[model samples]
Every structure is written in C-alpha cells, then in structure tokens.
Target: MSGRKYVTTVGVEVHVELATRTKMFCSCLNAPQGVAPNLATCPVCLGLPGSLPVINREAVRLGIVAALALNCAVNPRIWFERKNYVYPDLVKGYQISQIAMPLGERGWLAIIGDDGAEKKVAINRVHLEEDTARLAHSGDNSLIDVNRSGAPLMEIVTDAVLRSGREAEEYVRKLRAILVYNGVSRCRIQRGEMRVEANVSIAPEGAKELGVRSEIKNQAGFNHMRSAVEYEVRRQAGALDAGGTLRQETRGWDDVNQRTFVQRSKEDAHDYRYFPEPDLPPLNIDPAWVAAVEAALPTGYEDYVAGLLGQGLTAADVDALSRNDALGFLRLAASAMGDKTVLFAKRLIKDVFALANSTGVPLDESRLGPSAFRDAALLLENGKIAAEGFRTLLDVLYREGGEAERRAGENQLFVETDAGAVAEAISKVFAENPRLIEDFKNGKIAVRNALLGRTMKAVGKRADPRVVSGLLDQALQHQGRADHDRDTRLPRGKS
Candidate 1:
C-alpha cells in the first residue's frame, strides 16, 4: 500500500540578460549577436591581470527600474562579492555577484495559480551579476565563446510557493510580461537571454517541514522547465514511497531523454567562499533618479492585462501580444477605435499577426502602424471594402508600407458600390448557371450561396458579400414566382 499523498513545493530562479550597449564592468561591446569569437573581449571582461572593474551606471539604472517594476525595495548601499568557483569558462577564478546586499528584495508578484485564482508569490531578491562565457561541445572538442562573457545579468529568485508545474509556468509567464512591459529586458529564452532554474521538493501530506530539493539547472525553455519540475516531483515521491532517502543535489535536464540526471551535489553558500570585492567601491543609488524611473514607467502589467481582458480579448490573445512585444501597438489602435475595438483586435491578431509569422518578421517591425491598421479595419467595418479586399489591402500594406486607403484604391480592392454594376454581375451569374437556377426554384434554396459566390467572382472579388447575397435572393425569388405562375396555368388551357 502506498503512503500518504505528497505535496509539491517549487522555487524558481530567473536569469535575465540585461540589454545594454556594453558589458557590465567594461566598455567591451555586449554583442550577443553573431560576433566572431574573442572579437568582443577586453581586459576587464577577460579578467586579465592588472585590469580594473568599473560598474556601468546605465546597468544600475535599468536594475533599479526592474526592481521598482517588481515592487522591490531598492537598497541604498549595495556592493559586489567575488563568488569563488573554478570552471574552464570562468576567465577569472571567481565571479562578481551580489548576495549580502543586492539591489532589491522582499518583492511579491501575482500569478494565476492551479486553482484558477490569483496567487501571490513572494520574491526573495533581484540582483545584478555578470554572465559567463558560452560553451559549445562537440564529440571530441569543447569550445568557449567569450562574447557572452561579462555581460550584464539580473537574477530574480522566488520563494518556495509554487505547488504544481502549471503554477510554475504561470509564474514565469507573468514575470516575463512584467519585465518586458517595463522595458527591463527582452527576456528571449531562445537566445539565452532568459533562463530558468527550478528547485523542486515533495513532502508527505500535512508535513510541517519541506523535503530535500533537487535543483534543476538552466532550463532554457518554459515548457521544459515545467516538465523538469513535474518529473522531479514524481521521482522524489517514488523514492520516498519505497523507503529511499532523498539527497540534496544539483541536476541537469536531458531534454532529449525527458529525465533529470545528477550533475553535482548542491552547493551551500559557504561553498562559493564569497568575499567582498576590494577594487570596486560600494554602489549608491540616487533617490531622485529612482523617483524619475518610477515616474517614467508606462503602465503596470497587471493593469494592462486587465484592460485588454476588459476589451474582450482572450487570455491566449493577450499572451500572443505580450510575447510578440506588440501590446503597445494594439493599445494604440484600440485607443482610437472606440466601439470598433473588437474589430481592430481581431484584425491585428488574425491578419497582421499571420503576416508577421508567415514572413518571419516581427509585428512591431512591420510598416502597418496602428493608424494604418485602424484605417483598414474601418474600411471593413463600414462596408467600403469586402472581406477579401481587406485581406488584400493588409497584404499590400504589410509588404510595401503604404497607406491602406490609397493601396485599396490603387489595387481596385474597394467594393463595387455601383448599383448598375452589381445588378449586371448578378444577372450574368444567373444566366450562366441555369442548373443552379432550377435548383433554387425547385426548393433547393441553398443555391443562393453559389449565386453569391459566382457574382463576386464576376466582379473580381471586390463586390460586398452582403450586397451580393441580397441581390441574389431577390433574383431567385422573382424567378421562383415566375415558375410557379406557369405551373399554375394548367398546361395551356387544361384548367
């Protein structure tokens, strides 16, 4: 028989690669983009002898901005400590990090938990550090690219409050949004700009203390991180059920094999042998500048999401907008659209987003600005352009960066509003399809849709579908009455 059920506890650490022009402590270019190996290095980034480290003021400012965005309290005096670790990628024998006095602490953010309610996850600290070099391993060779070395990295650590894989995923998703919305970091998980580490443990049901956790290190994808957490939970529960003792250890996720494997024993704080940096002095944050940063913030992430939901956007749509960094664009379009907000949202999500995805271009990089989208959506809403015409206009505007109204006219995509032209198209379609006409008069009323399609095709797809349907219905009714009258005449005087 199995023992009592277990409960999961998770703590996540998110590493964000701060966006800046230079390295954290040096003037070397912070080029994560493809730069030749060793080209972006300097003495400070490389930790050469006789070199000194200087903090980047802009990096400090951005850190403060992020801290305020996360509702963390800024420390007046913060300093760096050398985290002593020996590895091939570490140019120096130690890393300059902050734990004794970090930039921010005691923050809390909300996420929608597994129970479909708002959950407040406590944040322990948000600190700034430098990234290590990238390691690429082949079958027989290992290489290090120092371009990522000494880049600015910010870490956010959460308390052990998450209960499930989904809660952990939600926490990361919401954190990403809050950071991106505040212009903190790009948080691109694909590019290694953002990374996640989860500490998962499971305890007996109604236990008073937490169980020993295995740290899952450097999960680059959100779903992979969730999977690692869930798998670790199950593994721990199985071991405990079989009367096996769990140990504290660090592990790596084998994404291909879908399991966690031991990497090393978990390190205690003493293992790093942290000591204060003797070269660089302590950091002092200005209250005035922090005030300005708080003042300059655009809007809170929670409020923005709430407003988007109030506009009837689904949660998935909001996620798409946030992930693509197009929330501001949608907001601008909605600001001017009034009651047509839904139409604008639909067009932005359905049409504009499709173009971006298909072409491998970002939505914000497109020439279809909010005003352009607004004009196009209005054309569709006001019956000036057919649905087919609107799509054509969108394709053109997205490709060539032209005004929607001008392009619609240039391409002759506007609906054929001329009564005579519509009637002629309808009459030609009726004359072309006698079999369909017979079907209509014989009570196969669904033939009206075919007539409508043929009419639009005759007009080069610029005819409004509503107008085509109305005219086709009237023509079919007239033909049906004529056929009825002839049938009632009793075969040439038999009546």
Candidate 2:
C-alpha cells in the first residue's frame, strides 16, 4: 500500500436556491417548506401546453452577484438551453438550463488546501436555472412536492483542482459562508436550500493522465460530501489495483452505511440533447448594471476575518464567531462600540455565545441586539460590572432587549467599587480566619487565594476580584510589618 500511492482529484458542483419572492419562470410563491404540495406550481412549471417561460430578473441579479463574489467574469450575453432528460422530479420532461452561454465564467474561490497552503479552486461557470420538484419515498410509495419546482437555482461548477476530501469540504464551507454573508441564500442544508455533488477520480502518483471518474450526487451536508469523496477515492483505487476497470456512473451516498451506491450511468453533454430555449430571449447584461452589482457586494469573508484578526482578535475567537454565524451581528456591535471591537468580540464569543449554546439558541437569533451587546461590553470593560454580573445582564438582554446598564442596576448586579466597602469586607474575612492569617504570615502564601475567596463570598461577588485581592494584600502587609516590629522589640528586652 505504501508503494502503490494514488492522487485524488475532485471537482464539485454546487446548487443553491436563490432567496427570491417568486419562482424562476412563473409568479408562484417560491416557498419550499411548510406549504401544501403541488400548490406553488403553474402552467409554466408544470409543463402544460402553450405556456411560455419568463426569466426572473432578481434571480439573474443574484447569480451575477454570486459570480462576482467568486471572482468570475460575467458574460455579456446570457442564454438558456433546453436539457432533455426523463426523471420523476423533473415534471417538464425537458429542463431549461445553460450550456453554451452561461451567466458567468472562469471564477475562483480560495480554500486552505490539504498541504496547509492557500489554494484557489477554479470555477468553470456559475449559471441560473430552475429547480425541480422534490420526491419523498416511504413504504414503497413516493410523494412529489411541487412547491420547490420552478424555484430559481444557481449551479456553480468547479474545475478539477481539489486534491483531497478536506480541500473539497473547505471549499464548500467557504463558498457557503460567502453566499450567506452576501444574503444570497439561507444555505440551510437540512432544508435542502443548498446541495453539493462531488466528481472524484484517482490516478497513479505520477501519472500524466487522469482516471475514470464517478459522480456522487446530492450530498446533503458537508460531512457527507467529504465522506463520500474519500470513500470513492478508496473504492476506485481498490478496483484499479485488482485489475478491474472503472465506469462512469452516478452514485448516491447512504449516510447510514457510510458508502456510495450506484444510481445510474453518467451522461455527457450529448445525452442531454441540449438546445436553446425558444420562449425566453437572450439576456443582454448591461456593463453599468454589472458594475453596480459588483460595487454592492459586501466584503469577502476572508478579508473580513483578516480584518478582525488585525483588530487583535484571536484565531479561535474568529472561528467561533464565524461558525456561529454571528459575524454580521459582531460587525454591527463593533460599529456601535467604535474602537473596542476586540473587547466586544471576546465577550460575544465567550459570554454571549456560551449562553446561547447552553440554551440551544443561535446567537444571531437571540434578543441580544447590537446596542445592548455593546453596552454590556462597555460595562464589563469599565469595571462597573463583575464577571458574574456581566453574565446575568447578558441573560436579561438575551431574553428581553433593554438598556444593559439599567438592567444591571435594577438587578443589583453592579460591581462594588467603593474602596471603603472593599476594605471592610477584607477586614471581616481576615478577622474570621485568624488561623489562615497566621498561616499566611508563616509563609503559607497559598492561603492568600483562600482568604480572597472568603472576601469575595462575604462581598456577595459584587466587588471586583482584582480590587479585593489588592486590598487583602495591603492589609496583610501592614499586619506583617507590625508583627515584625513587636518581635524585634521583645527580643531586645529578653536579651
């Protein structure tokens, strides 16, 4: 096995459902879930005779935006083609897609490759089309839901550049992040808003030519995609090693068994019987319109992460904020807090996020708005609220949006900042623990922490720990000095 090495080559096709108000070729609602099946259908989407297809302008705009985000060049002339295929999901025996003139071409997305270096994955094309109805099977019977039919869908094809399953997963994750950041799609994989397919093949380590490839269809999640690609790589390698030939076919991933099973023979361009759509006119994208869309694009996810790191955020914190999909909220809170972005980011990642996770709520969906979050951070930074108080205030804000400072005050959660009060608390702790004080003077320095804990407990955790510790150390020092003076005088008298 060590001597027989293989190189895995992977390319991906991603399908994203656009967040549009209506379907691609009809004015029916584009809702896919929680609606009665076959209701969001029309003559245009149902293949009824004599109904013509119309293009959705908003979908086209979103396609162009997504293309630009991936660094693709928009084609000046965009046209739709008819792809003929027979499938239960595709009601129209033929699907309207693009082959010759797509919306954009030659785009690239950056991903951290398997070798721990930044690598760019070449995108062949990003095109717009209509989605098909969904098929649900149960007990040897199948149900069709046309609510998803005719919904605007964007298909992005990548060049065969990925080298491993990890690279493929990272590419998809980064792509999904970009899409969601730009408000292009919800990208809810569980709900089928986004789907991924991997085309994988393996060749000898130094082979100059490629090997036969298999298409893995509709991996619902990133983990599933990675697993399927890796399994196929091994399966193909084993077949080649056993003097068995490989075939071009489509396969489905059985997540339960963690393997890929054959679905059908793969089809090429000729099999689709491609031709231009007769109803819709070719789209002539204006240069100015393209410029406007490009200008409107938000900052890329990588750049945003870099900026946050530059602002003194730890890599772990950035990853947390990104994975939780709270970067948008972070940006808003940062803007509200001005130069204290790092402070806010830390609190959000540590405190606010902890609360959200423990309660099974997403941070972005919580009632903690930017203003309230900013105020809480400021309170913590200024020493007006102790750690416990800050956490309590966060809970209040998460449940009901209100002024942070006011809420803290209402709950008596403010830090005990009075020096006299802290001194009194320290004195009481020292008096109650005379043995501990004696132990401390005899060089049992660890007792200092115990004394400090007692002091905080006495103060109801309202006094800042740092302040309490300082006061305790000062009182202990004074006591030690007085004891030293008394010891010296007594020694002379006894002599």
Candidate 3:
C-alpha cells in the first residue's frame, strides 16, 4: 500500500552569467559565441605560470545589485576560495568561489498561487564565482573549449521552501524577471545564459526531517525543471510503496523520453578539497559601496504588479501579464490610451502574449509596438473598427503599415451593429417565412429556428448573429397568439 499523502520538498540553485565585458580575471571577452572554440582564451585564463589575476569590478557590482533585488542582507566583507577539481575545461584546476562568506543572505521571494494566495520563498545565499569552459565528447574523442573559462558567474541558492512543482516554477520565473529588470543577465535559458538545478525529495505528512534527496542537475529551461521535480515525486512514491530504499545520487533529465537517469552518486564536501585561493585576494565590500549598489537597483516584481492592478486592471489579467514582457507594453498602452484603460489593457495583454507564443517570436520583436497597440485599442474602444475588422487591421499593421486603417475601412471589416436595422430585418424575415410563423402559432415551437435562419440570410452576415437571432425570436413571439411569448428586448433592439 502507498503512503496516505506526500510532502515534496524542493530547493533550487541557479547560475547566472553576469553581463560583463571581460572575463573574471582577464580582459578576454566574457560571452558565448559561434566563433571557433578556444579562440577567446588568454594566458591569464589558461592558467599559465607567472600570470596574476585581477578582479572584475563590474561583475561584483552586478552581483551586488542582484543580491539586493532579492532582499538579501549584504555581507560587510567577502572573499574567495579555491574549489579544487581537475578537469579538461577547467584550465586552472581550481575554481575561485566563496566558501566562508557569500555576498548576501537571508532574502525572500513572493509568489502568487493559482487561487490568488501569496507564498514567500526564502533565499539562502547569493555568491559570486568563476565558470568553467565547455566540454564536447564525441564518441572516442573528447574536445574542450576554454572560451568561457574564468567567466564571472553568480550563484543564487534558495531555501527548501518550495512545496510542489508549480511553486518551484514560479520561483524561478520571478527570479528571471528580476535579473532581466536589473540589467544583470539576459535571462535566456536556451542560450545557456541562465542554468538551473533542482533538489527534490518526498516525505510523510508533517515530517520534520527530509527524505533522501536526489539532485537533478543542468535542467535546460523552467518547464524542464518543473517536470523533473514532478517525475521525482512520482518515482520516489512508487519506490516507497514497493519497499525500496531511496539512494542519495545525482540524476540527469533525458528530455526526449521524459525520464531521469542516474548520473552518479552524491558527492561530499571533502571531495572537492576546497581551500583559499593563493592567487586572488579577499574581496572587501565597504559600507558606502553596498549602499551605492542598492541605490541603482530597479523596482521589484511585486511593486510593478501592484501598480498595474491600481491602473484598473483585473487580477486575472494582471497575473497573466506578470509572466511575459507585456507588462511594460501594457503600462505604456494604459498611459497613452486614457478612457477604458482596463479594457484596452486586457486586449493588448491577450494579443501580444497570444501572437508571441504562436509565432515563436518575442513580443518586443513583433511588429505591433506599444504605440501601435495603443492605436488599435483606441480604435476598438471608439467603435471606429468592428471586432472582426480589428482582427484584420492587426494583420495589416503587422504585415504592412501604409494606409492600413483606410484599407480596413474600405474593406468594411469594422461594421457597427445597428439595433434598429436588425429589428427591421428580422420583421421582414418573419413576414416571408409564413409556414414557420403558422407552425409557431399552432404550438410547433421548433419552427422558430427556421425564422432565425431567414433573419440570418436577411442580415447578410453584416450584423452580430447573436443579436439577429435574439431579435428574430422576439418578433415571432410578439404575435401574442403563441403560448410562449418572445423577449421584447430583442424586438425593441439594444437600448
């Protein structure tokens, strides 16, 4: 028999490639590129003898900004230690990272749940370190690219506050937004700009101690991270049901088959043989320096979302816009288009997000800029364009710009629903369909559908079909001879 319930404990570690112009210790470019491999390395990064390392000031500032944004308390003094692990891509044979003190600690992230509930996830620490290069293994031969060696990296570790797959995904997403907003990282998971690792385990309800945790490393995207955690939850539950022991190990996700395979046993701290690096000096972050970094930081995600809600936006719409780049566009649209700001804001959010997802293009790159969307919203609100015509207008503006609105007008796509004209048209249909009208009077009520068809034909698809059908039914019942009288609102047309 399986356990009554499951408590999934989740923790995440993310590596963000700092937006810096040079490597951590050298002047070489600190960017991933299509240029031939190993061409971007220099003597300092290659760990040649008699070469000293210099700290990159810009990388430290970016890391500080990220820490403050996450609400971490900055450490007064920071230092680096050597994580000794020999590998082909790691030319230095020892990574320079923080051991004794990280830049910040004790921060928290806020997440809104599916039912509009709030959850606060805590941060353990935020530290700065250097990244190793890439390794490509081709069957019998092994290749190494040192281009990324010594690239400045920031490691943000979260406490095990996540309870489920969804919460974990939300945490990562919010973190990505903050990093992008602060201009610290590009926040691209596909391009290896940001990397994620999740630690997952299952326990009995209200258990204080955790189960044996398995670390899933190098998940490529946010979705994959969520999937890995969910899979682990199920797999471990099955094992416990069958009387199997949980092993402490590392696993890799095979995204193609949607299964995780064991990579190796979990490592202990002694395995890395960590020690202070002899080459690099201790980082001393003065009081005034941290204050400056905090001053330039951007607004957090919660504040921005609150501002949007205050602008007459529905909570659901605000939630939708929070995940995408549309927040800025929505803000701009609301400011430019005044009346019915809420309605216009909702439309822009829906269209931009829908188009961006379907076309696989970023919202910022789509032809409809904020100003263009603002124009479309104004036309929609003022009844200058019909619902159907607005769709066509969007297509035209996306493809071609010259005289697009004029062309839409000429095409008659934006037809207004005239209530009087619709009532008149329905009356004419009732006059022509005599048999259906007689059937209705004689209590054969289904014949009312025939009158509806006639009215649809009379309108020629120019008016709203819903309004036309409603009016037609009402005109049929006003005869008063029929048992069930039709609605007068439909016959009188929209007020």
**Which 10 consecutive positions of candidate 3 have the poorest summed lDDT?**
486-495
Candidate 3, overall lDDT? Answer: 0.78
Q: Give a tens-digit lDDT track for model 1, residues 1-495.
A: 385699999999999988889989999888646779988998898889999999988788889988988889999899999999989889888888997999999898988888888889999999999999988999999999998889999999999999998899989988887877666787778778889999999999889999999999989688999999989998999899889999999999999999999999999999999999887899888788889888977667788778778878899988777778777666667764355766677778888888998988777556787788888888998999998899889888887887879999999988887768888988898888989987776667676777888888898768888887787777777786787687752212212
User: For model 3, which pairs clash?
Assistant: 386-414
lDDT of 2 by residue, 1-495 (tens): 345889899999999999899999989989745668898788998989999988988999999899999999999998999999999999999888898999999999988788888899999999998999999999989999878888999999999999988899999999998887776787888878899999999999899988899999999899999999999998998888888999999999999999999999999999999998998889999999999998876567677788888878889988898787777677777763246878888888888889888888777567888889988888888888888788989999898778998889898888887889989888899889999988777777778889988888988757787788888889888877788887842111211
Candidate 3 lDDT, tens digit per residue, 1-495? 554687889999999999899988889999845668888888888888998889999998888888888989989888888898877878888888887799889998888864569987899999999989888899999988889899999999999879887898999998987787566887678768799999999988888899989999989888999998899999988898888899999999999989788999988778999888788777789879989777755445567666657877779887676556566566565653345567766776666566667767766555676666767766666666645556666666655543545656766655447879888877787677777776666667777777777776776534556677677666766673243445322222222
By lDDT, is 1 or 3 better? 1
RMSD (CA, Å), each prediction: 5.6, 5.7, 9.1
Estimate the TM-score of every prediction.
Answer: 0.75, 0.75, 0.67
Ranking by lDDT: 2, 1, 3
Candidate 3 contains a number of clashing pairs equal to 1
Q: Top lDDT: which candidate number?
A: 2
Output the TM-score of candidate 1: 0.75
Name the lDDT value of residue 25 in candidate 1. Answer: 95
lDDT of 1: 0.85
Worst 10 contiguous positions by lDDT, candidate 1: 486-495
Residue pairs clashing in model 1 are: none
